[model samples]
Target chain A: MSALLTVEGLRHGFYGVQVLNGASFEVRQGTVTGLIGPNGAGKSTAINAISGALLPQGGRVSFAGTDITRLPPRERVGLGLVRSFQLARGFPRLSVFDHLMLYGQGHPGEGFWQSLTGGRAGRQHEERLAETALSVARRLKLDHVIDNPVSALSGGQKKLVEIGRALMAEPRMILFDEPMAGVNPTLSAQIAEHLTALNEEGITICLIEHDMAMVARLCDPVIVMAEGRKMTEGSFAEVVADKAVQEAYLGVRHDA
Target chain B: MLSYVIFSATTAGIYGLLALSLNLIWGGAGMVNLGLAGFFAVGAYASAILSLAGVPVPIAILAACAMGAAAGIGATWATVRLRGDYHAIVTLGFAEVVRLVAMNERWLTNGTDGLPGIPAPLKSVLGPQGFAVFYLCLVLTILVAVFLALRRLDRAPFGRVLKAIREDQDLAGFAGKNAMRVKLIAFAVSAGIAGLAGALYAHYQSYISPDHFQPLLTIYIFLAVTSGGVGRPAGAFLGAFLVILFLEGTRFLGHLLPGLSSGQVAASREILVGLAFLLVLHLRPQGVLPERIRPAPAQ
Candidate 1:
């Protein structure tokens, strides 16, 4: 399959501390790619640079053959690139149903004039979107608390809602930043299932996660990063077995 | 007596609208905006100028709202990239710049003397009695509409994204929300509402000056929202009412204390207002009407 996203020689830093150095990777279409590394391995930094949250000092990022290295985060989103955080962020004061509807409304109905006088068409569109969102909520098993504020949701539920929000954007590619962090076993399974299903439906995913087992289960190809650079890339089994990957995780042994 | 009560209530109602706008940015969206006075001043000046030029009242009101929205956009452009204290400082600077421009632009704003004798809406049709009633009803209607719209927005997904931005901006960005754009919009809407209130004030009072759009007025509205509950739309109304009541009710106290001069009474009122604000912050840090904490829906 053709590459959906390509990053070449990406470099980023904060206050003279280099976070991502000469990182290179490619995300294939309709595939789930897992990015794993130790703490401060620059996993999130790579995602930020690719998603345009942090501008890389040097490198190229092309999404579907378009250079997106300098595109703003919203522009990237407009181009069907979306992302989720390790820590699920929801509007605590907003209802779950409203959350979904807002994301759906991202397409066309949010303009001031449209919101003010879009009239029955707008209302009807919102209704249809809400209905569709409710169905998605049902699949996520978040149907009952649709009207509840996100603040009231458990940690895992918030993660599901975050995923739901990304789905609402109808993006072709989504970057998952530790979706399984702090989630329960049951919820983790549910998330894994959802991701698997999404991948089956031809959505491209780049997941930054610490859980190797979950990454192995859901991701087809795995990329490893160490100290702001790409250490290795292959099947999860191959990458885990690499001596360099092990040393990167466990540190250099004097015996070796 | 009824007239006085209605007048106070109507004034409070306009202030309530202003507070609601401020609450959206400061309380709901976690933006520390201090340029509200600028937006408010623009609305007041725009409406007053249009009315003096013989424009119809509805058109003048629209002009005022447009000016207010423009001011909002301006403020957003200035401070949207800034964070926390820096943002607050930029907004404060913008308010000062606006006030200075209003004071110096003699051709447009008539300098510090201000434009007076501006006609209220429907004045010819309603006369004094009818005009007061009509204008009060108009202002109240707008307030109600704003209240409803804000309430709806507060419950919607857009509001959720704003809250998410408030809690963790970086995370919100990852969640496909453009945090800067959202904050900018929130700031603009908040300023627009404040500007609308200024327009109403200009028409009702039939006069406006740079003095009328002082930074202190912005601070006073901030007090209302902070005391009422920062993020609650209803709290904005409650806060405004409480503020006006506290300020105006003390007039009776001045009358009771015959020995005190008018100047003394004014000074005392300021002192008391400050003290009351401190007391409220100490006692109910979240204000009188705290943000409603809705539970997560049942599984």
Candidate 2:
């Protein structure tokens, strides 16, 4: 399968301390690729660079074969590349339903003037988007609290809502940062299942995760990183069995 | 007495508009703009100059709004890249600069003397009292419309994006929002509304002066919005009314206290305003109208 996203020689730093050093990876279409690393392994940095949150000091990011390294975050999102936060970010004052509706409206339809004029096509498009958002909320079991301010939801529910928001965008690819962190086992299962279903429907996913079991179960090809550089790339089992990967995790020593 | 009440209400209504505008930038979008007076001064000057030069009143009003928007856009361009207090400082500096220009630019603004004999709006058909009442009605109508429009915008998707940026800017960018652009638009809209209020104030008072648009005016409006409720339209109105009442009520207190001179009473009144704000902050930090948490819908 052809890759949907490609990153090469990506390097970034803050205050002269390098965070990502010549990191490279590829995420194929309709596949779930796992990125695993120890704490401070630059997994999040790599994801941020790909999502256009931070500019890399040196590198190229191509999404759907188009260079997007220099694009602003919003433009990148418009191109069907999106990312979810490790911490679920939702409008504290807005209703959960409103959040989903807002995400749905992100699809280009009505400009400010068009919305003011009440254009027939724009209204029709908005109605459809709203309907789809409701359906997605129902599927995610968030319909019960649709009108509640997102701040009122539990942590796990917020994560699910974030996923719902990403889905509303109808994105071609999603980069999830620690989707299972601080989530209950039941919610984690549901999230994994939802991601699997999304991937089956041809949405590419690049997940950065710490839970090895969850990563192994969800990912087809897992990429390991140590100290801001790629350590190995292969099937989950082969990657876990690699000596370098094992040493990186447990720490290796050299004696005279 | 009723005339005085109406006058006070009209002034408070103008302040309500100012508060709402500030709330859009400072409360909704988490932008700290301490230069509101500068933009207000711009609107006032723009409308006053244009109207005096025989431009139609309505056209002058539009010009005022455009000037306010331009100032807002300029401030946004200068400080949108700066975060937090840095942005606030830049805006505050811009307001000071605008005020200085108004003070020194005698050719256009008439400097400290200000423009006198400015025509009251709708004075031909409605004489002084009638004009005052007419202007009050007009200002209130505009306030209601602006208030409802702001409420609608708050419920819309665009407002949601702004709230997201306020909660966490980094996450907002990650979710596909251009934080800077969203902030700029918010700032511009807020300034436009403030400008509209300033235009109304200039015409209602039938005069324009550099002294009218002081940094203290901006602080007073901020106090109004902050005390009323930082982000809500109703809060803005409530806070402004309360503030005006406190400022105006001090005049009545002088009658009860015969020994205190008028100047002393004025000074004491300023102190009272500060105390009143402190009391509100202590009693209700969320303001008179705290934000309500909406309950989730049933499955």
List the candidate 1 regions with Cα displacement exceeding 4 Å. Answer: A15-18, A38-40, A143-148, A182-190, A250-256, B54-58, B105-110, B120-131, B145-172, B178-189, B254-263, B282-299
Candidate with maximal DockQ? 2
- Give interface RMSD, per candidate: 4.6, 3.6
Instruction: Provide C-alpha RMSD values for all models, in order.
Output: 3.8, 3.0
Model 2 in CAPRI terms: which quality? acceptable
Model 2 residue B160 CA deviation (Å) reads: 2.0
lDDT of 2 by residue, A153-242 (tens): 999989998899889888999999999999988889999999999899889999999877898899988998877778789999898788
TM-score of 2: 0.92
In the range B1-299, model 1's lDDT, one tens digit per residue, is 77787788889888888898888888778887787888888888888888899898778888888788777888778655678889888889988998999889999999999999987776877887777777779888999899888876765445656676777676565555678877877877888888788889999989888888888988889899989998888888789999999888987776677788889987888888899999999999999988775443333
Clashing pairs in 1: none
CAPRI classification of candidate 1: acceptable
